[model samples]
Target chain A: MHPAGSLIIFTVLSGLGFGLLAFLGAGVVLPLGWEAFVWFAAGYALAGGGLLASVFHLGHPERALLAFTQWRTSWLSREAVLAVAALGMMAPYAAGSVFFAQPLPVFGAIAAVLCLATVIATSMIYATIRAVPRWHHWTTPAVFLAAALAGGALLAGQLRLAGGLFAVLAVALALHWQAGDRRWRDAESTPGSATGLGRIGRVRLFERPHTGANYITREMVHVVGRRHSAKLRLIALVGGAVLPAMLLALMPASLLAAGAALGLHLVGILAARWLFFAEAEHVVGLYYGRAAA
Target chain B: MTDLPETTDKKLGLVIDLDICVGCHACVTSCKEWNSQGYGAPLADADAYGPAPEGAFLNRVHSFEVTSEDGPPQLVHFPRSCLHCEDAPCVTVCPTGASHKRAEDGIVLVEESMCIGCGLCAWACPYGAREMDPAEQVMKKCTLCVDRIYNENLPPEDREPSCVRACPTGARHFGDLGDASSAVSQLVAARDGFDLMPEQGTKPVNKYLPPRERDRATAAPALEPVGEAGGFLGWLDRALSRL
Candidate 1:
């Protein structure tokens, strides 16, 4: 795919946003404190609303509800179902925390699990597609989970943590960056090896079968150079990972400062997400008179 | 036992010969004529008189010239449409179960009513077969002329697919590929056939016979002798010579 910037931002931004909300809801529903309600609601609202915003990137957003209909086979459908499920669980969990008496820790734990389910569902949406070899792997879903959790940890550090949470989140961010980097590298190194071609060889398209660009070419033949990607990675590491970690670590735990730090982290994560799609090479790229690697 | 029972053993499919196909687009024309009037949604053409126009076609023959240092220039005529793979990704991706693979014939079909126009099926396809009808906002592809082939009202001999029937060179064939002993299968086996992008693992049931062996000796059009008196052109030449 051409890797629409809007979609990249949407998935990553919404992922972090919702991920934090789910995590906050988890903390609220737990016996953490009723004082955490505003933070939790704010976080959930940000992420949930962000996720909803991501739908705008789709060509046919009107049919979004039908995305859940194929739960029998589609991972996308599973993701849809889980999104609704998380929303359902969080509404009660949030309500119990706000209007009613303080809820028990179990409530937050349930909300946490529901939030995690949404993350899994989102990840599986890309991972399930067998056609895109770069995406159709175990690492894809793992990477998504890691990024979401990392975002959640960063949010938690920025919001509630008094001392060492920043350090922990920094370490988590570093780990995620490393893992994501390796996945992107692996995807690049793997040549456009189609099925039935057992022995890999350096193959180049000497001739293309068409004159004008076809739909497949337009959609799948996107190429991002190594030099550009390297620069983007640097930006992501600095802006998305290292800087956010430093800001969260150095800054005071006031709502304004913490919110700013969270915002910075969110920007970084979005950049990282965009690079993730950009760096990943599709096998179909080979058909478009380009080297997949 | 003579008049006991009549068995309906029809295994309908498409057989495209890559060699004889000149990519004249006659099949595309014939297909549009049959399908537009036959069934389902109209394949609309946009901007017919304007600078740019787009239209839907069940069958489109693409001409490609594949050249290499190892072999001579090969003009490959690729007629693209739905292959209706047994493991069609489009079918699996459809949310409403609108797209389905027939158990009997292995023909993948879409039920228009259930389709929500998500366009996910289009993304799943590697062949770029499924096109979203802008008018109806539903996915459309080659149905292999389903409405006509089995229509008992049509004459028995005329029941063949329009494309196959219209092909002057006998390049396109329609038959059941499921039966190993069937003509289509036999033809495929006799001639080592190939499918487009088989690496996709769609397991497309449709088979394409490679270009026929060109007899280098007899391939070129034979020319007449310099002076053939009885020939029409020769007589005209003699008259012109006298003048």
Candidate 2:
């Protein structure tokens, strides 16, 4: 739960891009015009830039090409493979929409499905983690999906859609926050379970394995200051869902207002994503003698 | 390719006895010495002589104090390494096919050459088992001493994990757990060895023997007086009986 900057940017921005792509592909906006071109361009740029930024996280970026080959089992692999397929399908959809000013139902349909699938796959990368108790829940995907759609709707200038999605996102976020906070303190694994000492009463750490931090401690045992996390969670709620909903509701057709909403929503989503990473409690932390986890 | 085998022929793993392990870190040291120049990457240290040393280790020993219902607190030395689970989540989560389970022996391993160093395998492991080697930029874990155990160059008696062989108290054990009649399995059955974090459902092959409680009531014998039933002895005995 290091909350690496690259991942935060990648998940949030790509989520927005994919959400916009889905809306545009379904012709939910309108009859097709120059604005549609701008929307598609911006969407792809966000998605593509986010994807490109992800490479920096890898120590051996050249070998990242191999990650796409394991889509059968790995969620990360599935994300890699589905991202490529979705992006590839978006090429013709973008070109035809921008050049001919005609929305092809076939390309749009394929791109729409792929875009949604890609987002689900991205969320599954963390949601499927059995070791991270906070993330291992049904609400994880629901929150991710709702947040992406809400962000995408705002970015695409669909005020009504953004408003509705924000309401849904707010509900999802509330549910996630309630469940997440409860599970953070009450993880099923205990100190006894961690070391297999439950048969005896009151097991406690007398000594740690080492004085200095190892990979497990350094990577898995990240602590978020409670006050800071609470503040950030509030910011995520207000900026991500509420502020955008307010802005879009008051100034429905204003391009400037839409831009402002997207900016505020981005900041909020970034903070939410950061919290998502920071709050994740890996089960190994229990072994480190932080038994409260 | 990341799929684990339907069944491994022999589930070879370790059975560490918590009752006998004295937290001496013999296994930790021996594992480090033998693996420093291993078949895989060297167990490298970045700042050995510095104020803080950051290094990667496959096995570590953690000591804990647990108080039972009947007695005072006791120190429990727990050695943690890769469990080499039957349903190894690390193998399934690897984006690359580098992290794998050996079909023959059920030893979970990482192919250094193919590893991308993403650390996803480490994230998937709940036991704090998979450790990333910062020097090699790949995940490293207990291979159950695959190099030494199968090496014909060594003597038959020495054909075991360095940790198991180095333990002075013989608390560390290594054998085929798949066989019901194996020495390790029998020991597990006899000692009522239990799995760590059974809720995780990894079905880990490695088991830990809980510390046996010492009997305080029958431990010492009663002392007899040299002169019975006389003078001060009689008066003291009558007073003690009255109290």
Among the numbered candidates, top lDDT falls to 2
Error of 1 at B56 (Å): 4.2
Determine the TM-score of chain B of model 1. 0.81
Residues B1-243, model 2: lDDT tens digits:
689899999999999999999989989999988988876998777688899988888899998888877877788888999999999999999888888899999999988878888888898899999888878787889989999999999999889999999999999999999999999999999999999999898999998998897657655676786766878889999899999
Q: Which lDDT value does model 1 have at A85?
A: 73
Residue A256, candidate 2: alpha-carbon lDDT? 85
Q: Summing lDDT over every window of 10 consecutive residues in candidate 1 chain B, give the lowest-scoring window.
A: B1-10
Q: Which of the numbered candidates is closest to the native, going by highest DockQ?
A: 2
Q: What lDDT is reached at residue B32 by model 1?
A: 79
True-vs-predicted CA distance for residue A39, candidate 1, Å = 3.8
Return the DockQ of model 2: 0.67
Off by more than 4 A, model 2: A30-37, B217-243
